[model samples]
Structure formats: structure tokens, C-alpha cells
Target chain A: MKILVCISKTPDTTAKISFTDNDTKFNESGVQFIINPYDEWYALVRAIELKEKDPSTIIHLVHVGPAENDAIIRKALALGGDEAFRINSHPGDDYYVAGQIVNLAKEQHYDLIFTGKETIDYNGSSVGGMIAEFLELPYISLATKFELNGNTATITREIEGGEEVDEAALPIVVSCQKGMAEQRIPNMRGIMSARTKPLKAIEPVAIDPLTSISSFELPAPKQGVKMIPADNPEELVRLLHEEAKVF
Target chain B: MSVLVFLDQAEGHVKKSSFEAASFAAKIAEQTGTEANGIVLGEVKDDLQSLGKYGIKKIYHAADAQLNQFDDEIYTALIADTVKSSGSNVVVLSNNFNGKAIAPRLSVRLKSGLISGAVGLPDTSNGFKVKKSVFSGKAFANVEIKTDIKIITLNANAFKVTEGSGTATIENITTQIPRRKVNVREVNVVKGEVPLAEAELVVSGGRGLKGPENWGIVTDLAKALGAATACSRPVSDSGWRPHHEHVGQTGLTIAPNMYFAIGISGAIQHLAGVNRSKTIVVINKDPEAPFFKAADYGIVGDAFEVVPKITEAVKKLKGQK
Candidate 1:
């Protein structure tokens, strides 16, 4: 069985976010980037687990970004992947990114495709469903737990206030979230061997972005704190009613 | 250009977020000089006409029993078909679980421009530009969609629901529930006083409370204020709280009216999840916790002493009211 895991690099969780070029582009000066946790922790780790269980399962990692993302791809390869492919282009929208991936995955026809639920940077959880839609396969989003037996994949998806268990045949697409797998760190041997793993940069396909960003603005500045004495807990409730009117 | 809203349901009742979607659709329809309509799949128990209060002029409900269970593919096809028949050029849905699953597929099926988690109404002067939360609610962006058929999934509580005197007539639509591909086995529901995402009032805890045994300090306050309970990542990772309760970049990002943090030293990631809140209150022993910088109110005290006093004060205030 062949598995294709889509990965992306996002600003580190602790990285301070500031925009550039009048907020039309994200500022990258001195910003640290890492494999999106959802991709590295949930999607890729689960694929590695499947490969560990069945040695015949071949896992491949795919990324759609410029050359800077190659470092992130090598890190993903360090986790557990036969090869990594980077589509060297910056997509202005999620659909275009999905279009590039769909083009690549279509030729491979892998039995299973995996992606993080959403990138922490954009928080637009659309790529998985868009890929499945273009591919015309069953797409499950925000999968918390996934299991495979024979050709059937049973998935537990996180819904509004609960979770629902579902099953679909192979050649399916899944977007993973927190409970799908645990986080793994690359060790010395894994990092050293990752350098020798195959990392290919492919030419990009032409797809127009459906949407364009005009500008970005920071949320309104917060009102500084109003300190209250610990002994005056009652004053907090009174202020909640009179001053804030929140309660 | 007609506007259509997908009123998502759970346990045969339309969700509150769907109403917010309705108001949003109404805003677009009013702007475009069109009528706002709605569609509901499965067995919905609410009076369909009452949705008119939210400004929908008509409702197309497909009451097929099989449609009750969420199959995004089937629902996508159905919504696409309804859009074709109704001659609607715009679609609106709450950017919650169901909308997140369907919007992307529907966009591809209809070949339309899609916006997920829109926080502002579209500015249609030159082209259709909508403001959306980005970078996990830390920043906002104005995005332009150039497609004729546009799909928008609204963030929870982004638009306020306003009731008009109009009552929308129900139009029953016939849709074929195709052979199911994703078989649903069982559902595990967590019953809370308020759904965490939509809660206007929230009380969140961090690992400083120690363990699950000491969660009473957090819950006791939340129960008194009738607020939802949330946790920082470490607390959820330690298994002291459920993963859904984790309110950070990786968990659920929420924007409540009042956010009370206990024992949490706000990390940048954790702040990204909740910085959109209207007001924030932080209570902790350490005076230098980062959350205090973001909070509207701060009380430097131990959680054990501070939370109980606040809970009692809230209960006393409610009783007096």
C-alpha cells in the first residue's frame, strides 16, 4: 500500500507574527518555521505507525512551497518516508495548492492520502476536502482516530459537540487532528540519515488563485488590565455588571 | 443573485450557529438586492417558518431520514443541486464542523470561490471582498473572491442574529440520498451547559491547579457564572482535561465575551486561540504571568482562594438579581 502525506511549514508556535509589504505578505525576517504540528504530529506520525506495522507500506511526503520549505521536507523525511516531493511554488489560495497536490496524487493513485486538519498559519482547513473533491474520493476531515483492516478504513471524526465513527474503502483522503497520533522528535541517527533520503523538487502546474489577499490588519489593541485587590473579589462581580456589562 | 444558507442540524434540531449563518446571508442578500433563503437536511424539529425571524424568506428542507447523518459528499451534492434549482449565486454556512467539511467540496463541485471562517460582511463595491480571521485570530485579512458563485462559512458568533417580522414559507425539496460511502457507527456526545465554541462566557484553567482532583476550583467558578470550561494545552495533554477543552493554537480557538483564566501563564500560542475575546480576566498567583498583559482585568492571588470567592460572589449577585 502506498501512502501520500501532504506537509507544510508554518511559523513556529512561539514565533511573533508581523506582516510585510503593507500586510499583503507575511514578514519572514528572523521568523522561525517548523513542520506544522498537525502535519508532523498527527498525519505523518500515523503514517509512520502504519509503516511500522506493515513493512510493505511505502510512505511519501509532499509539500507545495518554494526552496525554503526543502528544509522542512527533509525534516519530515527524517520521521519516516521513502521519498519527498516539493512542488516549488507559492499558492495564493488553498484551492490552487490543492490543485497542485491533486495533479501529483492523481498520477500516483495512492490508496491512502493524509493531511493535517489545517495549517496553523492560515487556519483554513480546506485542502483535504478540496483534494478529495477534485479526486472524487471520500474525504474525511478532522479525524481523531483512524484504523485500517483489509480495505476498509474506519475513522472517528470530531464534529460539533461530539464524535462520529465512519468507514470508507481505501483510496480515501483524511485530515487529521490531535488524537490521531502522538508527537515524535527526530533523533541523531534519523537526522543524519535524512540527508541521504531522496528529496525532489518538481515544476509547478499553472492554476489561477480563486481568491487574493488585499491586506492584513492586526486585531484591535487590547485594553490594558484593571488590577483589583485579591481581597475585593466582590468588586470584580460588581465591575463585571457595571463597567464591563459582560456577566 | 439569490443568497442561500445551509442550516446544519444535530439530533434533528438546527444549530444556533445556523441562525447566525442566516443573518449573514440576509446581510449579503440585502446588499445585493436579492432574497435570502435557507436549506436544511434531515429531520429538523424546529418550526421552519420561525427561521424567517433571522431574515430568510424561504426554507428548502430535505427531510429524508438518511440525510440526518452527516455524509459531506452527499450533502455537498444536495446543496449544489439546490443552488442550481433555486438560481442562487451565493451560499452561507457556519464555519463549524459540518460547514468545514462541506464548503471546500461544494466550492470544487460548483467551481466557485470559497471563504472559510469569514468574520466580516462582504464589501461589494469594486469586487467581493470579505474580512476574515487569519493566523489563528491574531490578525485579520481582507480577501477578494473573483468568482460569480461565492461560498462563505461564517465564524461562530461573528454576526448577531436579529429577528424580523417576516416568516419564511417552507419549500420541500426532493433529493436523492445516494449510496452511503462513509458508514457512521456511533456518536459520542459531550453534554455541556454551553457549547465551548459559542459560549459567550468561558473559564479556562492551566496545569498550575495540579491535577483533575483540583479542577473543582475552575468548574465551580464556571458553574456559578453559567460559563463553559476550557483548559490550556498542558492540562489537556496531561489528561487532566479533555482535549476539546484545550483553548490554544492547536486546540479550539474561541472568542468569548468574557474569558477567565486561572493558573495559566499565557503562551503566545495559547493567546492566539482566544485573543479575539471581547474581554479577558486573568487570576493567578504569579503577578508576572503573560496572560495578565492580554487580560482586561487581573487579580494576583492563588486560584484556590480567588476562584471560590469569585464563584460565591457571582452566586450571591445572581440570587439578588
Candidate 2:
């Protein structure tokens, strides 16, 4: 089985999020970058598990970004990916990025593709579905649990108030979230092997981005909390009504 | 061309998030000086006309029983055809489960620019610019869509539903359905539980609540406020709460009108999920609880005592037992 996992780099979860230059750009000055948690913990880990189950399964990690993202791609390889592919270009727009992935998926003819439900930074959650559409393949989003039985794949996804059990054949796409797999840390052996593993950087298919970032802005600072004594609980209710006017 | 809005439904009724999508589409229509129309892919039990108050001029419904269950492939094909036939330059959807699954596929099929989790209406003063949250609600990005056709999925609770005097006219439309590769084997419907996504208010607990046995305070407060119950990651990870009830960056992201944090210390991950809430109230015994920093109201007291008092006060205010 040929499985490809798409990964991205994001600011560490504990990093303080801020904007810069009149709030027109993300401030990366003091930020530490790591593999996006969803991609590392769910999508990549699940593919590694699948490869572990079948010795012949090949897991290739693919990323669409500039050379700066290669370190994160290598981290994915150290975690279990057999090789890595990096598109040498900046991620301009979601559509442009999806088109790049589609180009690679077509060339590779991967049997299965996995991506996090959404990137923590962009939070677009659009790539997997777009890739599926461009390839005319079956796609599932936010899958919590999954099982493979021969050519049939069973997925359990959380819906509004219930769970939906879905089944599809091989050659599918899945956007994974929590409960799909646990996080795995790279050991010394894996890191050493990753150093020798092939990391390929290729040119992107020339295409104009459908959208461009005009500017960025930070959310307004929240006001100070108004404290009402624990004894005066009704006053809190009154405040919610008159001051917050939420009710 | 008219703006096309996809109204999402669950079980048989329209979802509250879909109303927001409709309102957003209508506002865009008003801004662009065009009309807004609606489309329902599945059989709906709710009155589709009453949706006109949100400013939809007409609703084009495809009451196909086969579409009762979500098949994104079929949905994407159906919606793409609908957009083409309707001559819609822009398509709108709520950034909910189904919308998330289908919008991108539709965008790819139609070769249109798509923006997900849009927080504000477009700035059409120049070229079309839509503001959306990036970095998980930490910042906003104004994106200019260069594609002639655009698709936008509105963030849940970002746009308010407004009621107007006009009633919508329900128009029946027909389109070709595509083959489905995925088959839903079974659906386990959870009844009587408040859906955390559409809840206007939420009452969430954390490790400070002690254990699952001490969860009554959370539920009591939720019940008094008619809100859904949620929990932090640690509580869910430790088996004190169900995974679905976990609200954080990795869990479900909700933007309710009000979120009451009883015992959560407000980790950045937890705040990433619920920070979009309109109003937040925190009640933690510890004065240094991080949640207090983001809360609109703070009560530095024990949850054991403060929760019940607040519940009683809410019950009294609402005249509930």
C-alpha cells in the first residue's frame, strides 16, 4: 500500500500569538516552530501505524512550502515516514496549495492520503476535500476512528449529536483529528535513519493564487473582568442582563 | 447573478448555524445589490418559507430522500450543478461539519476561490476582500478573492441571524446526482443531549472540579442556563468526561454567545477553542487561574459553593424548579 501524509509547520502551542507591522503579518521573531500537532499526532501517526501493520506499506510525507519547512518534514521522517517531498515555494493560498498537492498525488498515484483536519495556523480545513475533488476520490473529514479490512475502510466520524459509521474502498482521502492515533516521539535510531533518508525538494506547478492576503489584524484586547462578590450571585445575573445584555 | 446559500440540516430540522449562513448570504446580497437564494439537498421537516425572514428571496430545494444522509461526493456534484444553473457568482455555506466536508470539494470542482471560517462580511469597496480568523482565532486576515466565482463558509456564530418581514418562496429544482463512493452503514443518533456546536451558551468544567462525580455543578449550571456542558482536555484525557464534550484546540471549537468556565485554568489550547465566544465568565477558587484573564466576569471562589449559588440564582430568575 502506498500512503502519503501531508504535514505543515506551526508555531508551538505554548507560544504567545501576536501580529506585527501594523498587524499585517504574523510575528515569528521569538516563536519556536514545530510540526502541527494534528498532522503529527493524528495524520502522520495513523499512517505509520498502517505501515507497521503491513511491512510492504510505504509511507511518504509530503509538504507544500518553502525550504524553511524542510526541517519539519525531516521531523516527520524521523517519526516514521519513509521519505519526504517538499514543494519549493511559499504557500500562497489554500487553492494554490491544494493544486500543488493534487499535482503530486497524480504523479505518485497514492492509494491513500491523510492530512490533519486543519492547520492550527490557517485553520482552513480545505485541502483534503479539495484534493479529493481534484482527484475524484472519496474523502472523509474529522474522522475520529478508522479501520482497514482488505480493500474496505470503515470510518467513524462524530456528527452533530451522534456518530456516523461510513465505509469506502481503497484509494481514498481522510482528514484526521484526535482519537485517530497517539503522538509518537522520534528515538535516536529513527533520528539517525532520518538523517540518511531521502528528502526531495521539487519545483511547484506555476499557478496564480486565487486569493491574496491584504492585511492582518489582532483581536481587540478583552476588558478587565468585573468581579461580583460570591454572596451577591443575583447581582451577577443582573449584570449579565443589563451590562452584558447577553440574555 | 444571485448569491447561493446552502442550508444545512440535521436529522430533519435546519441547523441554527445554517440560519447564520443564510443571514450572511443575504447581507452579501444586500451589499452587492443582488438577490439571495437558498438550497436544501435533503428532505427537511422544518418550514423552509419561514427562513425568508433571514432575507432569502427564494429557496431552491432538492427534496431527494437519498440525500437524507450526507454523501459529500454527491453533495458536491449537486451543489456545483445548482450553482451553474442558478447563475450564482458567489456560494455561501456555514462552516459546520457538512459544509467543511463539501465546500472545498465544490470549490475545486468549479475552480473557484474558497475561504473557510470567514468572520466578517466582505469589503467590496475595492476588489472583494473578506476578513477571516487565522492562527486559530488569534488574528484576522483580509483576503482578496481574485476568482470570478467565490465560495465562502461563514464561521459558526460569527454572523448573527436577523429577521425581516419578507417570506421566502420555495422553488423546486432538479439536477443530476453523482455516484457515491462512500456508504453510510449506520447512524447512531444521540437523543436529548444538547449539541455543543449550536448551543448559545456553554458551562464547562476542568480538573479543579475534582472528578466525574463532582460534575453535577457543571450540569446544574448548564441546566439553569439552558446551556450545553463542556470540559477541558485534562478532564477528557483522564476519562472524567467524554471526548466529544472536550472543548479545546484539538477538540470541538465553539463560539457560543456566552461561555462559563467553572474550574478551567485556561491553557492556550483550551482558550484557542472557546476564545471566539462573545462573553466569558470564570469562577475558579484560585485567584491566579489563567481563565480569569480572558473572562468578562470573574468570581474568585470555590466551584463547590459558587456554582450552586449561581444555579439557584438562575433558577430563581427564570422561575424554574
Candidate 3:
């Protein structure tokens, strides 16, 4: 089986989130970056699991980002993949990013493709379905369990209040979330060998972004909390009804 | 051009989120000097005409049985076809599971600018700008869609659904139903539990509650307040709660009207997912749990001691004896 995993970098979960450039761009100064958790811990790791079960399976990682992001792609290769491709461009928007991934997928004809549900930063959750639409392939979003059988894949995905078991043929795109796979850390040997993996940097296809952020705003800071003593828990209910008016 | 709203239904019933979407679409239609139309796929058992109370005057119904089982590609194509024929300049839906599945594909097909997690109405006084939460609700962004045909997916519970005396005329439309590549085998829906997505109030517990055996604090309060129950990552990971009930950075991100966090030290991972909640009430034994900083109300106490009393008070206030 041949698989392609989509990887991207996001601010570390603990990093302070702020906007710069008149509140249009994310402030990257001194902000640590890591492979998006959903991608690394679920999608990429799941692909590596497939290869581990079947050694003949080939896994390739694709990321659409500028040159600075290629380092993140290399780090992904350390987890487990045969090769990596970095589309040399800043991710303008969902359309452009999905279009670039389609450019690579069209050429490679990957039997399966994977992406995390969404990036922690933007949380668009758009690119994977867009790619599936561009390719006219089956898409299952928020999949919790995925198992491949001969020419068909059985999956269990989360819905509003339940789980739906589904089956789709090969050459499908899955937007993975938690419970899809366990997280893995790259060992010393894996990290050293990742340095020498074939990392190809290709130019991105020109595509115009359809939407742009006009300005960013932060939520109003919470005023000091009204603390109710443990001895007076009933007072909390009164405040919720009379003061907060939420319940 | 009419504003189109895709009425999301489940088990032949319309979801509350879809009504919220309809209300939102009506506002857009009013702003654009047009009217809002509704669309529904699959068979709906509800009185479709009564939905006009939410402001949609006309509805397009494609009651194909196959559509009851959602397939993103098929739904996208069907919605696209409706947009083309209905002369809709804007499409609206709830940014829930179905919305998240089909909105992006519909955007690609129609070449429309799409905003998935919209929290408020468009600011059309200037340009077509939509306000949405970013960074898992820690911040907000005003995004401008530069396309003539735009799509907005309102996040669940962001807009309230108000029913008036208006009645809609339901028009059954015929469209070619495409074959779905993904086939669903079994659907196991939990019966009678409040779905977390559309729930206005939620009661969540964390590892501080300890074992699954002591989960009564969450369930009792949730029952009394008529709220859904949720859990932190640790509780879910430890098998105390089902994965579907987990809410955190890697879990579900919810924006209910009110959230109660019990015995949880609000980590950024957990807080980011729920910071968008309208009001937060945190109950913990530790004095310095990070959740207090982000909470609207705080109680420095043990969950076992405080939760029962709060639940009793809520029940008493609601006249539940």
C-alpha cells in the first residue's frame, strides 16, 4: 500500500497566541513550533503503523509551506516515512494549500491520504475535504478507527451523539482526530536517519486565496472570578441564576 | 439572490443547530435585501412548513432516502446544484459534524469563500466580512470573503433560534442522486443524552474526580441543570468517560452558553477548547488551579463536597424537590 500523509506546523499548544502586523498575521517571534498534534500523533503515526504491519507499504509525507517549514517536514520523516515533499510556498489559505496537495497527489496517485482534523491555530478543518473534492474521492472526517482490508477500508467515525461504521474503497482521504492512533516519539536512531531521508522541495502551484483576515480581535479578558466558599456551595447556584443568568 | 440555509436533520428530525442556522440566514437575508430559503436532504418527519417561523419562507426538499446517510461528496454536489438553480448568493449551515463535512467541499465546487466557524453575522456595512473564533476560541478574526458566492457555517449555539408565527411553503424538488463512495454500515446513537454540540449548558469533570465510580457528581449536576456531560482528556483517556464525551484541545471544542468544570486543573490544552464558552464555572480543591484564572465563577472546594450541594440547590431552584 502507498500512503501520503499531510503534515504542517503549528504553535506549541502551550505557546502564547498573539497576532502581529496590525492583527492580520500570527506573531511568530519567539513562539515555538511543533508538528500539528493531530497530524503527528494520529495521521502520521497511523500511516507509520500501517507500514510497520506491512513492510512493503510505502509512506510519503507532504507539506505545503515556505522553506522555513521544511524543518518540520524533516522532523515528521523521523517518525516513519520513505520520503518527504515540501511544496515551497507559504500556506495562503485552505484552497491554495489543498490545491498544492492535490498537485502532488495527482502526480503520485497515492492509494490513501491522511490529514489531522485541523490545525490548532486556524482550526479551519477545510483543506482535507477540499482535497477530496478536487480529487473526487471518498472523505471521512473525524475518524476514530481505520482498518484497511483488501481494496476496502472499514472505518468508525464520530457523529453528533454516536459512532457510524463505514466502508470506503482505496484512494480515500481521511481527516483524523484523537483515538485514531497512539502518539510516537522519534528515537535517537530514527532522528539521525531522518537527517538523510530524501527531502524534495518543490515549487508550489500558483493559486489565489479566496479569503483574507481583515483584522483580529482578542476576547475580552475575564474580570476577577466571584469565589463562593466551599461551605456555601448553594450561594454559587444563586449567583448563577441571579447574577450570571446562565442556568 | 436568496440566502440558502441547509436544514440539518437527524433521524428524520431537524436539529436545533439547523434552526439556529436558519435564524442566522434570515438576518443575512434582511441585511442583503433578499429572502432566506431552506433546503433539506433525506426524509424529514417534522412539519417542514412550520420552520418558516425561524424566517425561511420557501424550502427546497430533496427527500432522497440515500441522503439520510451522509456522504460529503454527494451532499456537496447536491447543495451546489441547488445553489446554481436557486440563484443563491450566500449559503448557510451549522458548523457541526455535517457542516464540517460538506462545507469545504461545497466551497471548492462553487469556488466560493467559506467561513466554517462563524460566531456572528457578517459585517456587510463595509465589505463581506464574517467574525469567527480563531486559535480554538482564544482569539477572534474578521475574515473578508472576496467571492460573489460566499458560504457561512455558524457554530452551534452561537445564534439562538427564535420561532415566530410565519409558515413556510415547502417545495419538493427532484435532483439526480449520485452514488456515495463511502457506505455506512451501522449507526449507534446514544439514546436520550443531550448532545454536547447544541447543549446550552454543560457539566464537565476531570481527573480530580478520580475513578469512573465517582462520576455521579457530573451526571447529577448535569441532570439537575439539564446540561450535557463532558470530561477532560485524562478522564476520557483513563477510560472513565467515553471518547465522545471528551472536550479538550485534541478532543471536541465546544462553545456552550455555560460550562461547569469540576475537579479540573484547566491546562491550556483543555482551556483552549472551551474558552469560547459564554460563561465558565470552575470547582476545584486546589486554590491555584489554572482554570480559576479563566473562570467567571470559582469555588475552591472538593468536587465530592461541592457538586452535590450545587446540584441540590439547582434542583430546588427549578422546583424539582
Predicted complex 1: CAPRI docking category: high
lDDT of 2 by residue, A96-199 (tens): 88889889899999989999999988889999998999999999888988899998999988778767899999899999988899878899999889988999
Question: Per-residue CA lDDT of candidate 2, range B1-321, in tens?
Answer: 889999988777888888999999999999999999999988989999999999999998989888888898998888888899889998999888889999999988988888888999999999989998887776778988888888999988899899898899999877666677899998886687788977888999999999999999899889888888999999998989888889887788888999999889999889988998999999888899888889999898888988898888888888899
- Alpha carbon lDDT of each predicted model: 0.91, 0.88, 0.91
CA error at residue A21 for candidate 2, angstroms = 3.5
lDDT comparison, 1 vs 3, better candidate: 3
- Candidate 1, residue A31: Cα displacement in angstroms equals 0.3
lDDT of 3 by residue, A1-247 (tens): 8999999899988888888888888888999999999999999999999898889999999998888887898899889899999999888888889999999999999999999999988889999999999999999998999999988999899898888999999999999998899889899988999999999999988789999888898988988788889999889999999988996
Instruction: Rank candidates, TM-score, best first.
Output: 3, 1, 2
Interface RMSD, every prediction, one decimal place: 1.0, 1.2, 1.0
Docking class of 3: high
Each candidate's fnat, listed in order, reads 0.80, 0.80, 0.83
Candidate 2 regions exceeding 4 Å error are: none
Pick out the ten consecutive residues of candidate 1 chain A with the lowest summed lDDT: A158-167
Fnat for model 3? 0.83
